[model samples]
Target: MSLRRTRSFALTVVVCAAVFTTACTVASPGSPSPVASTAPDAALQPFYDQKLSWGPCAPYATTATDRTAFANPKFDCARFEVPLDYTKPDGEKAEIAVLRQKALDQDARIGSLLMNPGGPGASGMSALTSIVSGGIGGGPLAQRFDLIGFDPRGVGASMPKIDCLTDAEQDAEREKTFADPSPAGVAAADANSELYAQRCTERVGTEVLANVGTRDVVRDMDILRAVLGDAKLNYLGYSYGTRIGSAYAEEFPGNVRALVLDGALDPQQSTIDRAVDQNAGFQGAFDAFAAWCSQQQTPCPLGQDPKQATTVFQALVRPLIDNPLPAGPGRVLSFADAQTGVSQALYVSAAYPILFQGIAGLATGDGETLLRLADFYYDRAPDGRYSNTIEAFTVISCVDEERITDRAQVAELNRRADEVAPFRSTGRGPVNSLDPCAFWPVPPTSKPHVPQVSGLPPTLVISVTGDPATPYEAGIDLAKALDGRLLTVEGNQHTAALQGDQCTDEIVTQYFIDLVLPPEGAQCKLA
Candidate 1:
């Protein structure tokens, strides 16, 4: 991805599948539920029955750039109202911001194609703009379907935004020493977690926090489908968005026209298992980066030996634990920051050169480039104001997974993580030393389970073999769970579809245009 594209891509924090079965009967929309009752409450029919008034995309309060971007005439925006709690439909209501780009070929247009760009907290509206403006995959998918994007509850441009800390407070928090695996460190980290949760509850209200899990979001998606007059939903979700897509298929299998889930998240994995898997994945990506760096005779920071590259990289970052390097006038690069910077760059092969330059500078005791990378990961603008990405990410994750409060268990997980990905491990622990969920005000309502969905239209699940965020095994598991066909992209990027990979793009386009399912175990090699 180019720098422009990377910036447009959501800054997802890396805190966070299977096989095929026999084809089941496809259920059409308006048919009896194929799955159990996980849909929106029928009592809230007014909200579902409400009509959308499309107009110019409204400006978000965060930035002028975002405001201007949404003002593009090519995009039409609207707001959808949903209940704060599906269980209490008569209670509070929230507004969901939605955007749409009309299909280029109106005569041959398919229904609206809903898209989500991971983050669980990423702005789908922003993602839509990027896809339409970036000419992604030669815009074949866009030409065939009206692209629909919306912000989930408590996310960007949505009502009741999740706000925990001020920019200044977050800056100070980020600069704090990351806790080691010792008892004292764990205690300190736990205290910070408690403080974070307390602040969030005080700032964002407890009611909204309680309801932002995947289950609620899935319900909201169904409502969107109904309101938009789509008999069946045609959808594409990436990263954390895969969870949303999987849950939708699980709950409303009969309502799917077609779904494509890239960078699949195995719904059945434990929190520790996920963390460990990501650790190993990032380690693999790091090795790939080092090997690539070794071959470059000119701009290569690490010389022509993989082992030496690893040694040098380790030497450069090890000191950050005890003594952080000065990065800028007032900014410093801590061990956590260094780890975050390297991990951010590993998201795409196009970013390897940036990682090389950053690492090379770090080796010479210059931390400027690495700090910039870290800033990008955290979505901290130059002015120091941060987006609510981290805040929303924490709340959604905590509510989706069971809380971890036991110190001993956390320690054990950290030990395994360290062994698996020593270079990427914070040295402090597996969980962010300050495990936010440990002190989450709201307990998780959902547990890890396979989406036992059946009778769905042909869905495509794309998995990148070396994706650090969502591993390949999870994708296989998801495909199996949904009984959907699997398309494997042999690459290290997080999501492969429509990222200029011809094979993956063709498969995805065909699925949307003609409802075609690629052959079982189809593989797309990265260019």
Candidate 2:
């Protein structure tokens, strides 16, 4: 089937250690400075004092393909020890899996360019390997610096990985039928969410779950910088990864050499605010897709009238909620499954065609295509095994945000979300009515606050005007908070660095290579 192509970045694609050593105490204009007593407790001196023993990356590979890829001699892997709680430096510890692809020209290497691809749960190691293996565009940074990627604690390949549900359990959860947005439905959804939290707490333990917030990850990044012997950190973060970069700057302003935060998340926004904004953004993207579909020849999958496209789309989805269509031998397209599939496709304009095909297939009584999209979104492999991303995302997100136990507030947010994205918000009432964190075993340790990193060099913040995940407004807020230059990409996509846009590419590359900052209010038109 033909896929609809668009200018948006693909969403369904691609998916930290510490030490205390003398390298940690080295104070330079670009080195992390000592914080006040109220700040996060510093890592134990031994953490900074330890040295990494880098060797073959083969043993750390998580998949057969990854193992084969790691066979390349140039890629080196290692594990570094980090304190579980910075406050308890000498207490329990965790190991972070690290991957490094050395610069091609060692003599001209600027330094290590650390990267995080977001998810707050996305495996940075997988992201880096994909780039090195040419799965994604690496741009000039690949040649200029040693590309460093490490799975944050409680993440892939890292010790104490968050494994809330077994493959079979997760499959059952994903395949469970979702009820419509009635009171009973909402109650059932809440019960399911609570059950998920209980399982995570029971299976993963509260100790590691309590410490997987952005602040902890930022601390880990600093320790990484120290161990890598880089006086300053050169970093790139995408999606939720932007939060890491922003938080890092807040915690260690002096340690930042050059940072690029694409698809920026606003640090000050509440969880409800973020959900509302994202819903609105996705609605806008859907509208764009509908409008585009209307321009197609007669019998367009969504029909000729763009105005009725949303109605048509809703008609196609509503039936799934009541009587899910058979997607395969044993799988069916549940309302929740269809929603997730559509949401993932909306991330990048390039996937529009595939979405169109999937929707068209669904319209014609074939649910297989759309079901496949949902599986991809959930990172479910063909064998029915699931990645730990969803579990990790939930755990880390719960610890980072203020817990919401008030039913009234949740109901209010759900109402507002429905208003923001009517068609897409249909059966989501229950999904949004309760906070996923409410059932978390541990209470939140952090709260939303604007990052206040001072004395940092000029940082570059990229915001795509029509981004569905991290909206442009959040990017504006992030840039203003960091006092960084904002490079706006006037297009529909999530994150715009190194995505084949000459203008965006030139601006970012110049910032990283020459330490140049774009003038205030710089904008790159979609090409």
Candidate 3:
């Protein structure tokens, strides 16, 4: 994904899977949140102290090759069945694939460190395997901790997986309607958005949609906590996962053992408010990319200055608005397509190389590489298959946001985008609006409302100075809200935890190991 493109992507901090908010405390959702039941008073009693046996659980995967997909040998695969609706107690159930890595030092083990991979759709199970084996946590900490990942409800390996558009269909839609953002270029997008929305509603039904909100998923976390026999939930959440962590903290404050919310999302804002913040956030990252491109003009395809590169980049998008590239591999890129492509790329610094390469590809008149980047951005594959995430995103988002309340509002929001983000705003409405959810059977669970958290344990929040997704300010707000500390990296990108920011990593490691927070006003500048 292009850094230019990724920066534009929505920084979904676990509200509706893909991605804002303002104020110290946004209003809470209208419905009462499920209060977390406290652990039994004998939570630390001997009965709860069964020694966890560590070994490879093999039946889940067939062979070494299959297991090779995981990052560590310690990972034991298991399936956990969760209620389709916690409200029903004995409601229909779904199986969640889980990955577990036991601590190397059993005696020194703090507890389970559950990790979330942010895509209300990303495979937590798979990510856990990779991170554990590849030493995601690093050091003795890696050896001493048991890291676990689970596919969220309606996501990877979870039963009754919801997919509205086949991968091929979604790929086609992305290629046809997303690459270009103009009205004349997106007839297919309009049709697909409406059709995809309709199909998802039919496929998942109203009950499932209601069950997939942040509240329910947090409940799923609680269940996992109970089953794991952990007294308090120790968690590390990134992007959308931050919202998950916050919700867990809000609902089960006493259950929080240790928490690390990196690239945190502010849940107090409604969907539109959050989107607006992301729109601005991406623009901020683009501005930084522009500045960098300008300084490296000789090697860069876009102009020397940030403004010039932005102009050139927007011009490239402008032509496609009306005359899009030929659809390939069963998909076409629409305005939204471009937005998704750009948005995903900006979330990580490692994507910069790919972004420059793609820009150079387009500048030199070869669109394949950038197009592939767009496909990846949209989760479309060369074989024409797509991840279920896009569909899940649409289904869950419509049920969680007010952005697509009606068609007229959708149109007006698009207009507003043009005004707010003049260069890219017009496309924002088409790419950022809530069309897919407009026709959703159920209304958004409730507007994003978060209760103030006081007297919480020390927490660490990480944000980039020029993150185009969550915006550094949102991180600032989150840090302030949690009464926690913030470590702002002086660079442009999204999450900083695994981005090779040594200063930032050291601070995070220290927090997790020593529970030491960075001093107030602490900041790390890239050398």
Candidate 4:
């Protein structure tokens, strides 16, 4: 997990709101901003905006004993209500749950540091424990800033659950669909996409999907910033959260005081392009993992050579498409599930041990472990009653990016991926196709907006060279777009801030503490 500057070719690789408001009235494009927008809702926002007693803030204190240790140690819960629809301010309202760990150095507190875990749907509230525990970016800077984790709209605790399918049904459908990218694969892909669309439409109905987008949440963030009394927002966002951060900067660039976007994504790319790029990112990470596994073949199960290991992994994927492994009741891993597992595993090198275990298990007579790995990708729990992120992830994504209106476009992308990454291209299409948004009841109020972060505060953008999720190229692109600083980590994974790289962590800590920017092209060495 150590981070270091690998003087190599930047590791190249593949690869890769909301809001609230006091107003009940709706606004349209070119219309004046809502009057009561800055005001808190008398009904919901008041309570959330109210000062906390600082008592029993950590509702999960009981749950934390069995969990990881906290670095800053304090935890409190607060709820803010936001308009379900930003345009229709008077529409139905929803609550967003927030978790706070007040700065240890209260006298020198530097305002709230909002942390996003980035499922677009990831649970920031749960992520508080990690932040407090110093797992993310070492938590030292946290001593001067209260850490705030809010489950974004449609995510955990925030109400109006976005869950589209029960764990069991989702598993069954996945198993029945998703094959390799052959003729049979096409049929399976179509069936899977149709089933996914049907299931999501049946469960979520149509209205919820349309409302969840990056812009809504960004506005909600502004509301939160206002309620918190901070003149500007200090944010640390990862994965999809980077997209959220970028959108916020675009819409309210003036409000960005200090922002750290790790694992950055370029906002200019369409969803289809993002998917294709992401697939490439994973392919790069997998290639790196394969190389590492080859060097450590004594312990790894795949192979002694990277190419051999990939071949083995590809063979493993093909069979799973034909005969999926069953995990818990009503749960099985499909080709798509397997592909997603590989992608997710590549995001964190720590998952390599688990992937190795799963690969070994599959190579033997058991595929349950690998199947469980797939379960993690789908975010399914043993007892079902899903995490609410899967649904939210889909909804917000669709709102921000237009759907694949032409199936041929998807087909072409898959074909192109096959050219670049023969084994990894198949799943990006149908396996990771759009469902929730296709049937979303509402239309986007605005098109995608990519912000130009010039003349802004000195921002620190971190890109791990081998990051398989948000490609390093994105970090480069974003750093250029933001006209800020970029720190490159020579590692094979996703976000580097939390990975055990002392050098990267030190740079981040210094940036937050000193408010200084790294020189252009500054790189953190791998340990």
Cα error, residue 94 of model 1, in Å, equals: 1.0
The lDDT ranking, best first, is 1, 2, 4, 3
Q: Write the per-residue lDDT of candidate 1 for residues 300-351, one digit (tens) a residue.
A: 6666787676666777787887899999988899877887788888887767
The lowest-lDDT stretch of 10 consecutive residues in candidate 2 is 16-25
In model 3, the runs with Cα more than 4 Å from the true position are: 1-37, 40-68, 133-138, 178-191, 297-299, 326-336, 406-408, 420-434
Question: What is the clash count of model 1?
Answer: 6
Runs with alpha carbons beyond 4 Å of true place in candidate 1: 1-41, 426-434
lDDT (Cα, tens digit) per residue for candidate 4, span 281-359: 6677887777777676366677776777766777766776567776556566666666665555666665666667667
Compose the digit string of candidate 2's lDDT tens values, residues 183-254. Answer: 787788788888888888888888898898887898888888878877788898988888889988988887
Model 3: number of backbone collisions: 41
State the lDDT of candidate 3 residue by residue for 1-527, as single tens digits.
Answer: 21111211122221112111100111111222222346533422222333334345454432232345653455676666667776565668766667786777788876677888665566676556544444355565565567777777887666668777765556555544343345654554566667877777687777787777677677678767766767677787777778788887877776776678876677776555566666777766666666666666367777776667666787666565555554454334455455555555556544555666656765654555556656554555445556665566555555555645564655555555455455474333454333556556676664676656753566777777777667677788887777777777787666766434567766766666555667777788654
Regions more than 4 Å wrong, model 2: 1-11, 14-43, 134-139, 177-183, 427-433
lDDT of all the models against the reference? Answer: 0.76, 0.76, 0.60, 0.62
Position 311, candidate 2: lDDT:
84
| Superior candidate under lDDT, 2 versus 3 | 2
Model 2 global lDDT (CA atoms, 0 to 1): 0.76
Worst 10 residues of 4 by lDDT: 14-23
Instruction: Identify the candidate with maximal lDDT.
Output: 1
